[model samples]
Target: MGTRRPNALQWVWYTFGGKLPAHLSEWVLHDVTCRTWVLRHFLRALTQLAPFCVVVLLLPGPLHIRLSSIVLGLLVGLFYSASAMVETNEHRLIKHGYPPGIGRETRAIYRDLRRTARDEARRRRGWE
Candidate 1:
């Protein structure tokens, strides 16, 4: 049988960040594959946040004046958190052929991991 691929968390770290929490990584591996876990979580977060955003936007002037900064800050934090999580997951998905984007550093990481995976596969197949 073919050797198992590196887990999603490994791919995530190799592609973007340094490392992930062991529990979190295991969850990412077990529940998420091919980036579906992250995309699903992202959509879920958006669905939850959208109503709060709409309410904040549609609030009356008095309420807006009283709560605008607070609401905005909270929403901003939520968006940041949501985007980071999505990005972490996206990095994991790079193994499936997603482009790394236009940055030099990111492109280098993507290239390294892709090369490593390719080399390993070739080695296993006795094509090296």
Candidate 2:
């Protein structure tokens, strides 16, 4: 398997903390280390919360009450998601046979390179 993508079922499993097949390891690494990983994390968190939110919405309630419930649920859910983001991604990578911290390490290297390039450009323009 040349870095196969997860099927919808596998993706749902993954979104709920399950592991993908070994051949999907490359995809997992990209997911955890991508430039949009934070957004991906937030989206995953939201997806995890969607079912409960739907239940809450479906229950008989005033518009304001339902809206407030959704808001509070999302805020708390996203707060926890953001707080554990780094560790979660690291764990995901580890579960997929990546060395511990590799995701963070890779992102850090990319970030450093981008910063270096930006600084070089700034210096070239006499802006710093």
**lDDT of each model, Cα atoms only?**
0.53, 0.90
**Residue-by-residue lDDT tens digits, candidate 1, 1-128:** 12344465664444343444444443434333432545655554555466566776676677657377657756785678576764555554453344554223443565688899999998999964
> Each model's TM-score?
0.31, 0.86
Superposition error at 5 for model 1 (Å): 25
Model 2 off-target regions past 4 Å? Answer: 1-3, 120-128
* Best-matching candidate per TM-score: 2
Q: Tens digits of per-residue lDDT for model 2 on 62-127?
A: 989998999999999999999999999999999999998799899998889989999999898996
Q: Mind sharing the TM-score for model 1?
A: 0.31
